[model samples]
Target: MTDDVRNIVLGVIAAGVSATLGWFTRSYLWRRRLRRKQAFFGLPENSECLLVVNRDPGTDGAVHRHDVFALLELSSIVKDCSAHVQILSHDVGRQGYGEHAEFCVGGPGSNRRTAAHLATLLPGVRINTDPEPGEDRAAFQLGSDRYRLETGVAEYVLLARLTGSQDSRPVFLFCGQRAIANQAATRYLARNHEKLARRHRTHSFVLLLKVVNSQAYGPDVVEVIGDVTRTAQTPPPAPDPETD
Candidate 1:
């Protein structure tokens, strides 16, 4: 072949190699994250971890793409934490829609097992699947403390649950849009603080972090460790008397 043709062939080969190498690196990093998360949380095979990603209605495609990257980052964390993984999504009616990715370590009854594991990881934290009167599902509270956390299909809600409460915790909300994350955080605090206080009245604070696009929100977008406030109080009444 002529010199120019030979150089063109070499260039194409180099490009192909670079693309393959990039894909491999990404895959390796993702697996590492999954392992990290699993080990950090000590999630068993039956245990599952849920990640809620909030997105704007006008930019569903962008949100989805962003989550795909977030998932990879989360996967590395899960691997590091020694946990399993799954992916799900949620849409806030009239507001917007988002995605949810879950990591399951074990088999059937994983929810219960995962909850138990979480309790151990989150010391002094009261965990429950049921909601009290006017409470939301996917909610958990610190024992006798005002701190509460609620999870929806698309987002996670944190509340202080007391009078004059403010968001003091450095919480992170991973999403493609800042506005959507802020909105979700505001709604969660507005809707559930009172109810959370009734159940565990104490000094509590909630933080919201939104992950803007996967490229922007990297592996360190949401850290597992953070500060939280604790308080003592009586348990609130059940949401349904019949169920009790």
Candidate 2:
């Protein structure tokens, strides 16, 4: 080949290589920054967090499969945060939640730990259940807005991110009026973690998510009702150990 032609070919190849490397580097850094933003709890390197699942009291400690599926999704994001995660049932989680960050799944009816904590901390939100057997009615009341099970009406899940002055570890509550709503809340968090983290970087926040057509679309149709973080008043005093 002529010297001029050879020189042109080498220059083209070097430019292509350089472009590829630049693209790769930018992509890598962008993903790294995203992962950092998704680290909601901000646990230090190798620290542990708890995933508390619910078990049906009517059954022999059998967990709902949908809830486990949601946990798996959350686990992946938690893993990316450089934290060790341990899964536990609500019964066990009731013992302690002081040192480690906690992710409590399921609503008050299914997870008593979630119930106790919600009752103690979040006064504005209440989970109500039917006392009569064979009733399929459940509701989550946040302030004056009530999301109850009714024909053609929407249901909701309450997703709360909280931190206490006494305890540095944050507590995440994922509670739905129904099982589908519970799963939807988790999926929503996973899908929008970066946006959520940026919005709620340090302060605590509460989200009310509406699950449209939950009977049909399940978690796929979930949407945010509102960001009630500012309205979520300071957590009430911890219950007395003897009374609790």
Candidate 3:
């Protein structure tokens, strides 16, 4: 073969090798970022994160069965992260959460800390308990979209993530009018976190999920009903400059 042709062939092969390596590097970095993002919720290795839940006084301070089941599933999900998990009730959560990432389980009526944090962080999304006449469930008013829990067949839950400032730690909220629905919400987050993270880049969003045949399958089946993050941005009560 002529020297000119040989040199051209070598150049082409080198360019192809370089392009292949660049693509692999980009793919690796993207996957790593996703793992880190998903790990922030008490899933990262050596992460010091808290898992907050509410206890029913009627049940003698015992965690509800649904909450317990959700916790178990969460444990498995983050097992690889080897997160240092600390379980606390909403009562103490107000003072307990520091700079560490956290998972708040249950709704406002049930978990006080979750209510207060969400109110301060996401004031636009209000959880309303006033059931419609002849109806048995509550609704969430986000911007113009009013998300209500379906009666009989489907129930709804709210899964929210929050980070106010650049230095602020992340907080994940799993809530519903009923304990079972809360379980379904957490399960939904665990199952579809990748899609949620991709769609909502703000790192803060609310998901309205519908539980399917929860009575039969528990929280195993869930569907995303709505994404209220954009609408839920009701200008978080002008942050107290003093606190800032």
C-alpha TM-score for every candidate: 0.28, 0.80, 0.73
For model 1, the local distance difference test gives 0.36
Sort every candidate by lDDT, greatest first.
2, 3, 1
Extract clashing residue pairs from model 2: none
- Evaluate all candidate structures by whole-model CA lDDT and list the values in order: 0.36, 0.76, 0.73
Off by over 4 Å in 1: 1-42, 60-65, 92-244
How well does candidate 1 match the true structure in TM-score terms?
Answer: 0.28
Lowest lDDT 10-residue stretch of candidate 1: 92-101
Residue-level lDDT tens digits of model 1 in 1-244: 9999999999999999999999999999988655543332334444545543433334532443433444455456445444555454332112211121232121011123233323322234453444243343333354433323322213332222222223221112221122322333333333343443444433333333332232443322332122343321333345675653
Candidate 2 per-residue C-alpha lDDT over 1-244 given as tens digits, one digit per residue, 9 for 90 to 100: 9999999999999999999999999999987775565456756668888899897555688877778788887788677777899888787775655578888998888888888877766766656666454334676665556667653347788888887654477788888776667788888888887788778775678998888976667678877889876555544346678853
Best by TM-score: 2
Which 10-residue window of candidate 2 scores lowest in summed lDDT? 128-137
The TM-score that candidate 2 achieves is 0.80
Ranking 1 against 3 by lDDT, winner: 3
Q: Stretches of candidate 3 above 4 Å error?
A: 1-34, 37-43, 96-98, 129-137, 150-152, 235-244
Summarize candidate 3's per-residue lDDT along 1-244 as a digit string, tens digits: 9999999999999999999999999999987875765545524567777888787534778888988887776666556466677888788765634377778888776788877876787778777755344353467666656666664457778788888665556788887767788878877776776676667654667777788877677777887777777766675355567753
